[model samples]
Target: MRMHKVNTAVTLGAVALLTAAMGTASAAPPAGRTPHPQPAHPVIVDCVWHPQVRPADFMIACGDGNSSLSSLRWSHWDQGSATASGVNVVNDCKPYCAAGRFHSYPVTVRLDHPQPWKKNPRVQHYTQMSLVYTDGRPDGFDRVVTYSLWN
Candidate 1:
């Protein structure tokens, strides 16, 4: 009888604790008032391999919404691969450069070995990008900028 009573008490205590915890847990956004939606990931254009290919003056949109590569001109694009050159216009927030004026520097761009996108496997990504600063490093930037699409 005592064991049964103890078990019943323990069960009730557990139920009460759960109920309290649930009540204290974050509530869903007030009915009809939805939370702010997150920004969508920037779609990287498959310049070389896509049916509608864009070889020269292509843009690379980094999902982070900060930096992008522009004026990309592919010297040679064949067999689902490409070697290109472009300018990376980055926000150089340096000792004094981040005055809302983006800086541009020459960069070599490469695309190879298409892979499926992380969110949507139906779409493909270059999976590799090698940005080499040919005209020397910017005033406040690194010498080389390497980016892996899938990563």
Candidate 2:
């Protein structure tokens, strides 16, 4: 009985220690890795009609809150259509002011061919931008943020 009690104590102590470590890790960035700054209203550059073949990574600000899409790389693109994947990094502002941690979730974005905006026949814009998440969605974010994109 005494031997069983000693084993139980050791196991409980180890579990507690591990749980504490995990909490700390989540509360802050992991050691040796600096946190990347998230910008307010990140620009989706050249969002006009037939944009200048931007296969490079770009940021998209949803404008609803602090979370934004970061680091999009197009894996495929042809004839004004493109498919890419990126990350949605969010500021989890918990506890109080300035005590926030950023978390990244995998997401996929699609840009459809441009069409003339209803308001202006001369100006054109991508009719839609589809954002589908692969993992770790922030609270209140839909699995897909497919919305109309206009100039």
Tens digit of lDDT per residue, candidate 1, span 1-151? 9999999999999999999999878668778885654223222454333322444454455343346677877676654566778887776655544355677888888777766566556545566667788886656557766666643
Over 91-148, each residue of candidate 2 has an lDDT whose tens digit, in order, gives: 7777542687778889888888666545444444456678888986877879988866
CA deviation > 4 Å runs, candidate 1: 1-52, 55-64, 95-98, 118-124, 139-141
lDDT of 2 at 146: 82
Candidate 2: lDDT over CA atoms?
0.64
The C-alpha TM-scores of every prediction are: 0.50, 0.50
**Clash count of each predicted structure:** 0, 0
The local distance difference test score of model 1 is 0.63
- Cα-based lDDT for every prediction: 0.63, 0.64
Identify the runs in model 2 with alpha carbons over 4 angstroms from their true place. Answer: 1-52, 62-65, 93-99, 117-124
